[model samples]
Target: MQKCIFRFIRPQDWFAAINLKDAYVHVSILPHHRPFLWFAFEGRSYQYKVLPFRLSLLPRVFTKVTEAALVPTREQGIGEPPSAALGGGRPSPGFALSRPSLKVLCRPDTKLCFLKSTVNASVLLFLDEGYVKMYLKGRPITMYMPRDLVDTYCLEAKADLPPKKLKLDWVYGYRGRDCRSNLYLLPTGETVYFIASVVVLYNVDEQLQRHYTGHTDDIKCLTVHPDKITIATGQVAGTSSDGKQLAPHVRVWDSVSLNTLHILGTGFFDRALVCLSFSKSVRTNSNVCFCEKKKNRFLFSCVFMPFLSLPSQCSNESVFAADFHPTDANIIVTCGKSHLYFWSLEKGSLVKKQGLFEKQEKPKFVLCVTFSENGDAITGDSSGNILVWGKGSNRISLAIQGAHEASVFALCMLRNGTLVSGGKDRKLISWDENYQKIQAVPELYGPIRTVAEGRGETVLIGTTKNYVLQGSLDGEFIPITQGHTDELWGLTVHPLKHQFLTCGHDKHVCLWDSASHRPIWTKTLEDAAQSAGFHPSGATVAIGTQTGRWLVLDTESKDLVTVHTDGNEQLSVMRFSPDGNFLAIGSHDNYIYIYAVAENGKKYSRVGKCSGHSSFITHLDWSVDSQYLVSNSGDYEILYWIPSVCKQVVSVETTRDIEWATFTCILGFHIFGLWPDGSDGTDINAVCSSNAKKLLITGDDFGKVHLFSFPCSQSRAPCHIYGGHSSHVTNVNFLNDDSQLISTGGKDMSVMQWRVV
Candidate 1:
């Protein structure tokens, strides 16, 4: 059938088709072949009558016989060659007929479009390529698929191939909100965590990161195998880029090689895979116990083979976390809203028993669970209490009340047997074997979501605000990984250093070390930041806010030196003159506010405002001499301006002779080729030229970054395109040396550092 589709049909071709109803009954099998279909059932012998269902040779045989009969119609030019029994149900053959009367052959309610067996001709009927790919793949093309096939089939693709010559050095975000078991300290000194559709393996000691670009949507849960080398991560269901529904599933891979070993539950799980765990015992085969969002949707499956399931009578609680017993693979514990279940496998059947609170009141939710060295189940509840349940009794044997100031979110047992608990109160506390408080570290930045032990006494904490902190038992916890919580667009590179600053709608302005992919300092602002720029001396940086308020800060001390406002709107672009004499602040109010720089950018005075643009200013680049500027606006207007005179230059010939300091203008003559065909002139959001002026990189609305030769003057310009950001690539910038590139995601709230190879 596929061969027939390829031989006769093209995606662009259309026609009317006829489906021969009960077409298989039209052909009669020979007596000798009919005996082959004989069957005996319930002590009764049944002889073959018609073609049987699910016969492997039926489609081929029926298609051959039906095509022979339809050849006469094709010879008479009445129709094209017919395709018989495409669906194979009852030999409902289809023919593409050119006759106008045959157009109504397919009813409106029919799933398949009817086509006449005639010459390939145009018609009003349409078929989407996404559906064609879905039909070819023989399944729904949802959120999670291989990266290469995503763009062609997915409805919402969040993962794509990294750019050639551009390696994704790090992802500056952590998925911690309402997720658990997501942070792990692997044996190789790599910290495993996930953000968006990518799993990041960051090594704190080396300041390096490796990415596992597997999942296609938002990751919800992660777990490590007993070997500490194998890892499994799960993602929530999402639509593909073309709107195909993707199922929630888990992926197991080697942490060192970063090779996927297995993908579990593509079509089996629903809603989301909340949590998963690896059984400690692997003598026979590794087993994984996982739970999902729906009621009683739990499965105990082997990593390589068949699966066991819990009875349907199980509780309908939303499972939050699951763990296998340290010594017994059959013993599993799952915790969720107001319920703690102790599940065990016996005689190839699964059974569960509820853990009793005894004299203690039941907590609202059991947020996390872990196994102790002595085969005890330690569970943390929403009431800021920790309960220890005996393996035999399934009842709370020890209770530690007020272990934290707020609801306990995570509990971890270190190698030295020192138990640590983190909670919504922004505190990390340590307890001794007797459950007595040892020490408490308070004043954390955000609510702790998950906790894992690092080297020695240090513990890694995953926070709800997308932060991963590393701290010792007696020291302060410093954030090792941080990301914006809202849309981000502001991005600027240091003039002379391998450093950059980013700001976003989350109100955070962060100075980052581009080489290490780590934040050096972060300051929260009252209003969301929209644009940023650094002075040529790299001593002071200006951060523009959404409300037309801009602040210039001393780069060294991060001290605010000045604050000024133009109209009440967002500042879309901020650029400083290469000579360090002027600063341009382009606002959404359709004005560019120019300021004179003095005292090495410590002081600024209003020079003049460039106002001829009819729409909000989107981008601008100053000439090297600082006399002329080119700007783009939201209304697709590209205009040249003279900042000193605050006048728009209308002569194209005059502007063509000017040498610009930057080539970021999207609509300029030298770079007109940047716009693809059918584009409305706003597809490219940001453009940056390399320091050497040899390369131009662009960030577009579809989360793609393309690097083209400088002065791309040809339409449909050839370029090296890359994808990593799951949202719009709001901004792109290169380091002063042009050895590194940075791109910011708008809605994914991530900063991706790319190394130029």
Candidate 2:
């Protein structure tokens, strides 16, 4: 059941890989859809500023509203989607057009027939008749029937002459009859697949048998081993980082058990990995071999970024496509910004790497690549050209200019040796082996993102909008559809392993190994928890509650290590000092409480309360040396406190230590979260493991999260509003590598995990 969910997705439906930007916040509910979403909270009957997450039909509602908004834009010249190219199976005309892949089937001999016997001969002489014909095995066997059969046949069979039948894409199935003992493996998109555990019964709805998940990003590339028992998947990183680019991850899993065998992270700061393929020969360990005795994993990474530039401001060449050599298990070719790198999987080394652009020519990025059966390297570039290179050769063997009006996004070789390419210009072009452009299919659903060869000389086209098109040289086609079920709120990625934790008002904290995307365990809490953070050691989790109580729980046991009440009101903030020596609790009591952590965090004792805040403590962070504290309050005032003094830092009689340090938090989820400037935001809730990079993160009512590089003065601070939240951002924390930022949202009842790169 855990693994079967992945089968819902058709493997090449790339458009389904969506990272919704403030999803619920962007969906405006109509008056008709508003009634069910209405609710009263916090003594107010406030309707949602955006669509709430609790609605059962959010997906349908969202899709309907979205289509409504895009209708007018349709006239702007995008053509009708080809009805024939849709997958599933072509729906019968005028049947309200359901997806073709889900029809039901019934026994053939159950046809409707009607006939009556006139035994009375001369007594009225009125008779009606209908004939029935049935097929046995592929031959037709006719049977005469009475016209009265309408009353004798099942209503379901009479109303519909034929039973519904569902056809699936990517089934690439073998012809067989003893299917009861057979197994089926299917991809669910991204980092997951389904393993059919029970014998499959045709046309019958079967519960998901098993599922496996591990990839953290979209599974843009997939390869099945020759044995068909092991599957490899490549993940697509969302984007290169603001200040630096990072490489994406790849993994190999056993199709039988759905267990991950290896996670491949070959290089760092490279472009997002978009394509993958497997070699024909089974790999064996050799002396210079990069793989282990069991399997081979190779990584290809790109380089450093523009120094001092924000990750958003910085950019680099990235790998948009790659594929393995047709026969060699060791050779792989990758293309990016005007360059190609030939890598040896056995040694994890680049055998040949170089830029492909001519010195006097304008540079162009290669968007997709493929290998011919003859072992030639072929690529499609942004400049609208198809470039071919000989096997093991770096020189361009042939170049066909202006292959498409816009950049090409997909390329694949069919069994007949014809090369097909899809481009952003909405054109699909076919080229002969000698490089002559012969035909074109224009005005497709959208620009293709990827393509795969299908049985019977057909092709699967994954589009930019997440739809798939069944492409054939003779041109006959069907449409396939795929989205998240709930709002996400709290997200924390594991430090040492490829695991992460997520929790929300769903009342369950789900732990997952991102490499598998399968939940290891889920714990339902007794009450709604407010904010959460992890200790520096990654061994414990500290969560605060609305009732002014907080608990430090062991990550391994989920058992309370310590639960304490700080004030009469909510304890919105809980943070552990960088050294793990102190735990800070900021509350509604107009003071920040400090506790000394001892016995390796098993115990805590009250140190002293940092007082003098005229109002509730809004936010706090420790000094780099851990000797003093900086805090902000509800009155738009910031104070410097020497914890050793248990009071405000007073430097001299003329002027107290009224020095400015840095702004706390980003804008709040509430509009009022911003200060007088409307630009600089404020929040009563903020956190700081306060690392040496002088960086701290804050979230607020503005539904925004900001990262601050400190040593900042009040006049100006170097910061970035990093990511989005649907509602009030309750807390923000960094993972071990600080490559990803996690946050929890309040009211929205969701948690979203954002990777820095």
Q: What is the C-alpha lDDT of each candidate?
A: 0.72, 0.45
Leading candidate by TM-score: 1
* Lowest-sum lDDT 10-residue window in model 1: 133-142
The sequence of per-residue lDDT tens digits that candidate 1 reaches over residues 258-331 is 99988888887877878889999755468888787775477888876644445333457767888889988888
| Alpha carbon lDDT at 268, candidate 2 | 34
Query: What is the number of backbone collisions in each predicted candidate, taken in the order shown?
Result: 28, 53
lDDT score at residue 495, model 2, on the 0-100 scale: 48
TM-score of each: 0.73, 0.34
